[model samples]
Target: MLRAIAVAVLAIGIILVALVEAPIPAVALTAVTGVTILLLLWPRSSRDSVAPSAPEPPMADARAPIEAISDPLLIVAGSRVEQANAAARKLFGAHVVGEDVRVAIRHPAATDRLAARQATADQEPIELAGIGGRDNRWQMHVADLAGDRALVHLVDRSEGHAAERMRVDFVANASHELRTPLAAILGYVETLDDDAAAEAGTRKRFLRIIRDEAWRMQRLVEDLMSLSRIEAEKFRAPETAVDLAGLAKEVHATIRDAADPRSCDVAIAIDEGLPLVAGDRAQLSQLLHNLVGNAMKYGRPGTPVTIRASRGPGAMVRLSVEDQGDGIAPEHLPRLTERFYRVAPSRSRSLGGTGLGLAIVKHIVERHRGRLDIRSTPGEGTIVNALLPIAPLSSNRNATVTGPA
Candidate 1:
């Protein structure tokens, strides 16, 4: 640019000397034009150097993607939360969006980790309790992002933890149930063996007791095996057609003698033209037996224990067992179907209940593509209703078998 300016100046001086013979106004105009040309033709970059840098393709808001994610996620800038996803809002609160992450999260370890400049990748995940309530459990994981930003992912572990606790409880309960009968049988056997002076009647009575205890233990083992098998085949939906009305009557008749109906009246009611349900016949029969047996055993003395079968909505069969007895409390209704759960442990044991009856019934109903509903009011009666899909008359009913997946 300097060389161009010098050449232009020399040319302008020669132009003025040549134009000295010309008018002074014309010479002045010519010099002005020359300077303008030199300046306009100056060397320069193609791009507009003065314009601001192409405004950063607007930092593609990562929070948008996190909003669509199912897991709870939070984006934090320093100690404050810049954004929270829908799940995060639900787990915490909508106000958490602009709050301090440590305060919003309400966890000592997690808050400390977030506050620290450095975080350990191998640090054990901090457990968050009572996210929604005391029954819930969640795990928090924090990861560093660019520019003092961090991402926190929350995983809910409530269901898994509850299932694990239930497993542990089931094993313990089964062990205790099995041990009771075994101990009774062992004690009676030893007594009979050591006492030679035991009278004939006494010996016979002790033998009866031993037999009863052995049968009780045997029943428990059988129920446990049955429960295991049912769970193994839980995913397998039953396909064979079984008449539920007939099964209900058969169960009532089978248990009529043992029901000791002096204090309870066992009755069966059937609605005509009931559709056949697609299910495992043996399991369905057992389900009916357990329900009716429970009804008869628990119904108040002289009150009617009714077993009814009728057509349900949408091509379904409704089989119900109702007992007029001291009803169960509202709290016990939810856990009644859980394995080894009994409302009255001692009463249940004396009545030869292994506490797996309702649980078995539940599995069988599930296998049949059915729904079971239990309703009871204190001092009134309890009703158990099982709704099962009617077997399709056409083919393709057994296209695929569902089993535990």
Candidate 2:
């Protein structure tokens, strides 16, 4: 308001001076009037037209925060690389910043989907080959930002996918294993029932066959249940201190009593003063039993099977079952702990093996935070070693040694 009044007064003074024809005042007023007119009427300069303009909107920094994330992420702007997170840099190298989205990712499917003009705002999984010959999968989401820009987000799914595949395979394999024994039991029982009216000798043979099949089926069911329990309780270790030497002796006696005449001679060599292992006594006994039994079953007749135990590093006790049987091939050794996996399916079946023994042993050992090692050479011998962590034997719980056999 003050400025407007001053301007009005100046204009009036200029008009009066112009009318009175005072040369000095008239010239001063005229000069001031011309300056004011020029200030008001000069073409308006555009504020946005200035050089070195202001910074972009906050949306431009939308990707700045995500750059700190550890997981790979990409900011795609119309099929072009707008920005990439730190993880993406580490994954694809720093040269990917301005590179084409397709060329940078190097995955045809991912790139093609990203480049599709009609692509919907949906999330899809894309698998790609990563460094070091590893396979990587990403859950990709395409979202539209302001203007023609779009944001592509990547979430790793490789581990999740692998776990899902393993679960499916485990279910399939377990079902097949259970079905085989069930089919045998059912078939044999039906036959025995049909032949019940036959001669005494025939009836006796049928009954024996039925009994064997039933026992085999029972063993299979028992092993399956044992495996399930082991897996369920695998996260917690047993709170018992089991004597290594005593357990070995018991297992040795049991195996010897039950051994076939033609089977290998079972021997025990437990180191004196061997530390007790922390484990469930019954589970540990079962573990030892399975190992010794496996060795005897697969070992060559007239050979020797040695059960040895000694103090291992880190307060651990190592128990090993060594057999002079035809050793498993290298290809089959890795999978020996898998449920129902057999090196020689036919021969193993003939030997009355349920194939869940080693699998159960593995779960038990792992529950105690122990390691199981299988070392073998074809035609030589196979050794199964279980390294169990030992707890201090003071007021700690004592592991009961369930009788072997």
lDDT of 1 by residue, 60-118 (tens): 34444454445677777778888787889988898998898878988777777777635
**Each candidate: RMSD to true structure?**
21.5, 20.9
Candidate 2 lDDT by residue in tens digits, 118-236: 45555454555463136666666555544345555556667676777778887887777667767876786787788767788877776687677778778888887888898777755
How far in Å is the alpha carbon of 180 misplaced in model 2?
A: 2.3
Q: Model 2 off-target regions past 4 Å?
A: 1-67, 89-95, 106-137, 143-149, 192-197, 262-264, 393-405
Worst 10 residues of 1 by lDDT: 38-47
Q: What is the lDDT, from 0 to 100, of the residue 350 in candidate 2?
A: 78
> What's the distance in Å from true for residue 123, model 2?
5.5
Query: How many Å off is the CA of 215 in candidate 2?
Result: 1.4
